[model samples]
Target chain A: MPTDVIMPALGMAQESGKILRWLKSEGDAVEQGAPIMEIETDKVTVEIEAPASGTLAGLRVPEGADVPVGGVVAVILAPGEKTPPETPAGVEPMVTAQVPPPVQRTSGRGRAGRRPLASPKARRLAAERGVDVAALAGSGPHGAVLATDVESTGRGRDGSTAGVPRTPPRLGAIWQRMAERTTQSWQTAPHFYLSREVDAGRLEAWRASTRKRAGYERVTHTDLLVKLVAAALSEHPHVNAQWHEGGIVAAEEVNVGIAVAVDDGLVVPVVHAADRLELREVTARREELVEAARTGTLRPQDVGGGTFTISNLGMYGVDAFSAVLNGPQAAILAVGRIAERVVAIDGHPEVRSMSIFTVSFDHRVVDGARGARFLGTLADLVEEPAGLVP
Target chain B: MSSPSAVAAQPGTRELTLSQAVNEALAEEMRRDASVFIVGEDVAEAGTPFKVLSGLVEEFGPERVIDSPISEAGISGIGLGAAMTGMRPVVDIMFGDFMTLVMDQLVNQAAKIHYMSGGRLKAPLTIRTTLGATRRSAAQHSQSLHALVAHVPGVKVVLPATPYDAKGLFKAAIREDNPVVVFEDKMMFAVKGPVPEEEYVLPLGVADVKREGEDVTLVATSSMVYVALDAAEQLAADGVSVEIVDPRTLVPLDRETIVASARKTGRAIVIDEGHRSYGVGAELAALIAEDAFYDLDAPVRRMCAMDVPIPFSPVLEDLTVPTADTVAAEARRLVGKE
Candidate 1:
């Protein structure tokens, strides 16, 4: 049986990588798990291991070529394998591959699932492009395919099916899932956005006093907000609910996933039971996550399972913006920068500092009233953070 | 300060300028390897833009030291073609600013050909260009454009500071199978050091520690190397010892050396001649923050040229490029002294 070598995602958010070095040469016999190539994505270099033991057949993209996630690069034909599948002429290879379906759906076209013999991602790519995988011969390791084979064959991933789309799509596993889930959520759920501009006057004064008292060792506003959110979520557990097929599954623990923007994409590292941790602990955890994300070294534990989430673009000077709800998490709170604005204080126009927080929720689970109450409670806690202590 | 070996390893042993060392390296490499030839403007009979290739034509025959028409694009193209044809051609592109004209040839052709062709074609070409403000060549000629070449995929960019590295690294570039761009500071060429007479090939993508200290790690490339070393000395006087590192090649950047230094010092400041905006200094700052986050006591400070083109006026040009004073100030800032 031919084994497919897909593009290995270097980091959690990396959809693709540039081939920096090729360790193996054509005709060189390679073993499974052997380092065959070095790829650089998001400034970090990672070695790509060979999948199946076989003689190196072909390299689709040369070193230094930027390929999308799930796109194939090389092929290792299975021993005794002959006549690599012929590609449809004139089809260009996609930079990225779509997420593989849970099960192979045999679309009448015999070419489904066979992207050229490049990497594992490339193989999944054939199916995503709707190319006939079976008809396309792989030119990679252990009879695996490559992306160029698809390009060389000239057939779109959908395998000459009209309305299946001839224009090649560059989609990765996460992107495919993100798009599907986002579109589905938007279409079905009645998403109502509730944005509140809260006066952070007292909080700012408190933070300033704390910094002076602590001798220049100051904590960021995000740290204080995380504490406030944790307390608020505890008060309004209804907003922290997730939508399931049968019913709403309200999570028992508060695992607040903090969304960090890296060079590639978004990676949310969850702080488990944020309600139980101190402000210092939250700051330290967030710092560690940001570092890990920036360096492309985030562990699997850093990305999985969250009941609530927070994304801050305040540091980048962004005034206000909405964020896509990271599925499974019912609500994602977006925080913007604090600026001075005119407000009615004691029935007179007074300058007060305020910051906007926009909350996007899975309307199926979190109702507008629930989200509003959560934000209102969060605003109160930030104004009076002393109440956050147990 | 302690041992003879340690004392002998110090970067400055002679007053030879950066140009003199480059000339020595070129002459020595050409003499040692008959396959080595010199190309580019004024490189053969006219010497070099900085006179780094002055005596090569007199020593070697015109075939090995042939001059070409004034075309920066043509110079690199010929070098790349000849390198592909199996000749080690060292091209002097005169100015770092002029290299912009041949970006396609350098970045697309020279850098990608070997990798794109899957190692079928080898381009053993050396591009020697002068970088930095010397008598204010302005935006056209005087500029440290290492970042441009370093960002390219296959090309190895060598910005050697000392005479020893200039000789050793240049020889290494000539022998390397890939194309290399040797960026030398016009001012540093006159600053000499004692280079060994024996054959040596200092591998690219490695860093050299000019001075070792415990307070902060100072990483500077090319001419900024001397400024960093000088800052270290000044810092040492004030009870702050700065460890200075020069990454000889930027492409296969030696992360190990940089990270180790950062770890030791607990604070880091990167100095580069490139502009401060998204320059090599930014890359180094990110690298240190990523690897040595816990070790860092403060944010990494970068001393680079102001985000402006090198001006024609001497005062403006001097201010634009990172000076010794600026390097020292950044060093102090890294350690929280400023």
Candidate 2:
């Protein structure tokens, strides 16, 4: 009989481990108690030994792939035994095998047991999302797993939520805000859209050179967009004003909300006073805010008091998309990718770098002509932003 | 009845007490090499009171099996000088407590000569000593101080629990060019085991698996090896499989065998006859905890002598040291099989 080499649990919270290296090659004879592989998990490297004396055969879950604790990674076959003809690409071979039952995470909130220390809310969130709460290291009060911990661990894997739900719960603070504000804005405000294509080739090149010359480690395209949007709003204040109590309220502070999408919902952390700060300072502040949002550590002051918001899907390879008004804000700008496109140059076709910027405005607050004018001004400023910097 | 795996196999077998095995090993090495000699207080005339060096003087003659006065320092100094001058001298310290009398010679001279002389001189000496409580020998004659010798550098320490290891490891110790300390369990001198007829040498610094099972790995040294084996039989009747590993040599400790067995089993129980604190079990427990912690399912447990002096009363004496029943109980707790 061939002994199954299951992925060893490397820690109390480790459900799986990524194989860092394989010391023994497949089809090689191995002693019963020899190190066959090294696995890295939870920042620790653990060497795993073969379970039986045999020939290592049918390599599975190749190096750099993670295998769950109970999932078989490889097999040790007795002498003269051949690799099974029907062995799947990985062990626990056979894609048609009966799916194993869901692992019942130790339940109950009491301390001093196998059950992990976690709040009821965290447990509920993990259950709804189908996440293993025990596998997460808690960052809550006294290291108790919280709802936010589940969300961050899910996002860390970036859509590799193999066992997580396809649809998360629609009840977190961020989720409720999206539900209430979008519903209120769509039901009450008269909305209108205006879009314009801008050539951003010069802005992109200027940003690259500026960062290299200044020796700044990170200068993103979003920083330049915030500066340009702030400049355009200064030229056209109506686009940056809020509609409150049936009156136009122009914001004294140009606090632009940078909408960062996390695993479960989107959080809009503000880059306060964007128009006044230098480009590098804006880049630094904006980077800090986005990091706080992704790590689920944003404080109230970070997310409050936004006059306008920018939702950029450029990183997702999207050409353009529309965004709903975050309530009370006059408009939300949806920015798309800068890619080479065929366009008219004096009636002759030419390839130039272009991007789409669409403004979703509250029609009750700003008329069609004013919204169109705001987009046009924004396009001109973005195309030639040498004057906006410092 | 002993478990089948608990009894290690030998090629050609004969029964011998642990002391007889040591005597045979010493005689064989002395005959094989002319430079090999024995020197101690009662080693030549009275044969160590335990008869471990009984007939060596008659065979090798008085020059090679030289007797000495009650001066441990003087005796140990001569052994170190002989070793440096290319003689493989085996110095027997009649009792372990007298190690204090020869501390300077043993630690500074014998242990540091090679390093102090910048490798120009080597102390190829073997010091034979006895440890463990024998016949309620009280605090003086009864002590397991292998930890003290092991803590010193430039010295290899060996503790053999069975006759087979006593014979094999003693021969290997004589062959090593570095200073090696062979500590036998004083209480287990009469313990018998199967010995191979032909000469054989078991390498130092390698652990032997006295028993093999899957449930738990018990790492024990010296007399505790027997305690652990006895507990293995007890646990076997209760349907718990246990594996016992004896780390024969302490200085160049065999961490590979001990850690591998613990990782394989995922549960480790360390049993030692030394004191509970600052003893051999503490070191082994720390090693396993640091190296194989993730492989453990339950906490690593230690079954060591209570942190107190060995008592004179037999009843209290048994309580001071780890027993078979205590080892089995610890195993059950660690396995969560209680």
Candidate 3:
């Protein structure tokens, strides 16, 4: 079998890279570690070496094409071996990866009473854009109209290449699903937001305290908050409850999703069984999950399951605000920056560092009283926080 | 921006004007994915100051078509909030200069939200802002502040000079989970070309060569791309072959493209609209010096705006920023024009 030279993951966060040029063209012999091509990521441009010694048999993606990570862009065949057959013109060459096929056939209906099978996200995108999936070529793995294909600007407005503007393709199915989920959460949940200003002085003070920084792992206040929320959710399982079958149901495990901002969209990867892990384990686990999330190397198991979530904007110094509850998760806790504000300290006006914590919950699962109790418990624990960690 | 090679290589994909392409991409993305929403000043009811968001409100509905208060800070904060809670919000900050009001949210807050949380949270946000000097928008309103955002770790910055890139890059930015700031040059808004009606994404961090020649390389950004193109045309008349390089996305600055072009040409001149001190020109020049130093025939020449604030007067501003004439003059000088 010919060895495929796929687009290398330049950085864990990089999804795609541009092919500046092919150092080795078709029929050119190469060796492993030989500079084969130049790839540019969002932050750095590095040369990718040939994975193995072989002749450049075929260029799956042309010079200047932007290909996703793990997507095959070229083929390195054994000496004198033949390249694969040419793909149909105007269609994107298929990547050998396991991604579902790109949807083709611009017409929604196909011959022989065939209904074009597409991902629910892709179908929804097609319907919303009025795009006939059958009419276009599928760039995805198998002949599926990938969400990227649905928004591709293949033709100009005048139906002619002349004077026509190239429109960029739109968001994919993942973004569409995220939007729908948030919309559903906002629409369904009787959301009553309560914002509180906590004394971040203690959180910050603890972070500075030598006791917290005993090793290589530097646990942030956000990490502590995740642990605190997990403990709180485990203790008060009501907040970890989910809405189902016309009634509220609670879960036993506290799998908390940490909302991480990536280049394209937010991905909340779950810290499975957060309540069970000690603070040190929680810190290490959070690091591993975050590394995977930002690099887009997150496995299905890394992101797929979650029961509660935490979002911290405090480091960015957001004074205070409410977050939209990511749907299905019973509650989402928003943490704001630790700012020094004048408050009554020992019955006297004093400037003390404070951080705001806002929790947006699915009101159907937990009432205001219960929600307040959760926040109150969180506040009590966070203010001291020593009890929960030990 | 328009590149001769990109135009030549894919003559079919280079026709749309940058702004037209942005509008088309936004419209297409919004239409296709209900999850992608645009919230910016004058984006909805007012159709956008640059008219890029025209008819978006009617098409995507007000829920996705959000018009906000004149507060850049407030709107940016709102974009952050919406992004954190699950929605991908694309914000337009009217002018690049006004981004200062919200830098706290963008540079400090939006940029570091993910890493600081040790991977527990992410902010998928895109801020679209305008940068150029020729519109006579004057000192405060017209500035290329992409360098500021580029300095932030979590934020990805993309600057588009052509319609082809604007649309594709915008689509990519909307899909990114980290905060992305796209710098749209005011002058390139009307430079129309052919853009495919179908979906395509121009990945971030890639550079496109608008024109190719041998003697010298002209690396430009935004409106300066057009200026460099004009300079290339003028130099062609003089038999001096100048290669024009557009580093489309400045943060993921395409060092390979710049180095390749520089190595091929042996000389490079960076043209930008920002003030000369530590601007994008400085960064590009530094990279070339560090990586492609052996490839240079002469020291890398960076032709940028003078170290002075943008003036309200047209004549003063004219003298302050780079013009096609100055670019040609500088290119000619570097290539021994005088």
Candidate 4:
């Protein structure tokens, strides 16, 4: 029997993987475990290996085709073995059994018979609400009708007026996944935000001194924060825990995910066991992850097993912002830009570098008191980072 | 048995498995009417494989809860003859796959008796059968053939999804003047649900809104009812509110309720365990399209079993029928979420 080469599932929640390219051509003799194709999932792109040592035949799916997880992309047949007449086992036969010819567009009556692809509900709502569906562009696949399209008829996202329909711009894979994850977090995870403004004088000095060292020239405040957050998280295991199926599960390893903004959207790549890694190691790992994220070549391990996330918008010069929790994770720490501020020190006006740190916690996992204590620990570490940063 | 008023006032207080509910309904009916009796192969003691009629023989004795030969046709013919002569016989066909054998007595004879005899003759017979696959019974034992009997006019078809509906609908079937075929999902016999202790009868051809929502209407029957409900729950997490309408009865299907739900939601997906082509789903989809076409936002979709025979392998059998995930995916597509 021919061995079916299926689209491997790399991520836990991945449904499909897009084929990047076939490493080997059809009828090529290949050894088992040899990389045959490159497939990209929502999380990362990885090379798929040949299941058996055979001549690869029946390459069913083409390059760039997004086949579902476990779906057959090709078959590996023994030498002189013919391609079977029936579909390979585990493949949906119904999907391959029939192929209807594409409909050709005709003029006059044929053209008049063709209607805009809108859902039945959308059409009904449009009629009930006295909205012209034809005038509204759909956001659904192939411009099909959507209930939202009918409800929001005559109003575009940019507040454009009626008569001019606007098709919503398509989102890339990362951006779409980000949207779905954020929406899910917002809807399901009850979030509670705790904000604290800490003196960044010691943190800045630590970063500056660390940058002066050889091979640590790129040490950043975010990297310093990752180290500090990891230390504080080790002390506060409750904050490092995740909300899993209505219970708090303390993650054994404090894998801190750094939110990196790529061209497409936000991608969080984890720095595994940040608490154990040195400041320079954290910086090096962050750089590698950010680079991989930007190039869309992040491995599955780079994005998975994140117990907590740190999103630093300080580079953008933003004063302060609270982020949504990266769901399942108990908390996410958002860092703001460090700026000079005058404060009364011992009843005298003194200048200090101040930065606002906001931590968003999943209320189900971490309570207000626990979150405050964690934030207090983080603030203390930020104020006087003597032994922690070194 | 508790009084009808007591149970009716606080229905669904008591929980019972579908098996227990059906057994209770039979015992209640036989006690209420002396003319009512049970006839099937091994139903007297063995309870017909699923043990749905266990202990019924002790309550009504062997004469009333009689066991018959393995011939489905013979038992069905006997039930039809007894019904015509004034007995309300509840004929038990062990598996719905065997319903094909009783077609002559059920469809040709029982279904056409009243009409052919100019309303002078009536067959107050109820055939309790089972439908649904994934039982590893292979093609011969596992088949959802309710659509076959439902196609005939004189006969009525009711599928009970819950224990409450199972008991109530079974009682109503016995009281029905015309021939009624009750197709129960054999796998659901052990499924427990809230059933009132009091005596009650659910009217035929009435649809039950198992769960109410607005985004889309899932018109599921029998085994598919639970599938649709599971899908609805999943879709709810995605922010798509799905309305589940279970048309407990198929023949005199409650077109009004089904159509109204489709109109209200503007989308409908009919789910059935029968084969996709010419199945209950196709008929429901057609009815919704014909009645609620203008109100619909998407074309009516049908999620039914594959046309192939139910495979014997557990892995292969699972693929032959619609599941919660598949139903949810289809619902998501209709609502424009996918």
B1-338 per-residue lDDT for model 1 (tens digits): 11111125334344355567677778888878888998877777678666777888999978889888888899889999999998999988878888897788889899988888988999998888877774667787777778888887888888888777888898888889988988877777667566655557798889888788888898888888878877777787778888888887887899999989987766788999888888899999899888876555456788888888788988778888777777787777555466
- Tens digit of lDDT per residue, candidate 3, span B1-338? 34434453254454665667888888877777777898888888788878877888888888898888799999999999888888888888999999899799998899989999897888999899988886788789878777778877888989887777788899999988889999888777887766775679988989998887898899988778888887788899999998889998887778999989987776789988877888888999988877776555456888887888788898888888887788888777666564
Q: Write the per-residue lDDT of candidate 2 for residues A115-226, one digit (tens) a residue.
A: 5656554676677766776666665444456555677655443446454423232144456556667899899888888888899888788787777855454778898888
Ranking of candidates on lDDT, top first = 4, 2, 3, 1
Which has the better TM-score: candidate 3, or candidate 4?
4
lDDT of 1 at B84: 96
lDDT of 3 by residue, A1-390 (tens): 677887887565567776657788767899988989877544334578898888875565554445777776667878766765641112243332222333233221211123444433345556665566655455433454444455463433334332211332344334544676778888887777766777776666666662445662578776777888887887798889888888888887789998888766677878889888877787788899888767656755677558988888776768777888877777888988887789997899999888888998787888888999989888877787776644
User: TM-scores of the first chain across all predictions?
Assistant: 0.59, 0.59, 0.60, 0.77
Per-residue error for A6 in candidate 1, Å, reads 58
lDDT of 2 at B185: 80
**Best of the two (1, 2) by lDDT:** 2
DockQ, candidate no. 2 = 0.01
lDDT of 1 by residue, A179-287 (tens): 6666776676556677988888877876676555443244567767777888888888788788888589888988888877665456677887888987668778878
TM-score of each predicted structure versus truth: 0.46, 0.50, 0.46, 0.53
For the predicted complex of model 3, DockQ is 0.01
Model with the higher lDDT, candidate 2 or 3:
2
**Prediction 3: B-chain TM-score:** 0.95
For model 4, how does the per-residue alpha-carbon lDDT over A1-390 read when each residue is reduced to its tens digit?
A: 888898888888888887767899777999999999988787777887899999987666555446778887678998878767653443321221111212222211222124566777677677676666665667676667677777666654344575334554445668877888999999999998999999999988888888888989999888889999999999999999987776788999999999999898899999999999988899899999999998888999899999999999998999899999998898999999999999899999999999999999999998999999999999998898768756
DockQ for every prediction shown: 0.01, 0.01, 0.01, 0.39
Clashes (backbone N, CA, C under 3 Å), per candidate, total 65, 0, 70, 9
- Which residues of candidate 2, in runs, are more than 4 Å off? A1-390, B1-11
Docking class of 2: incorrect
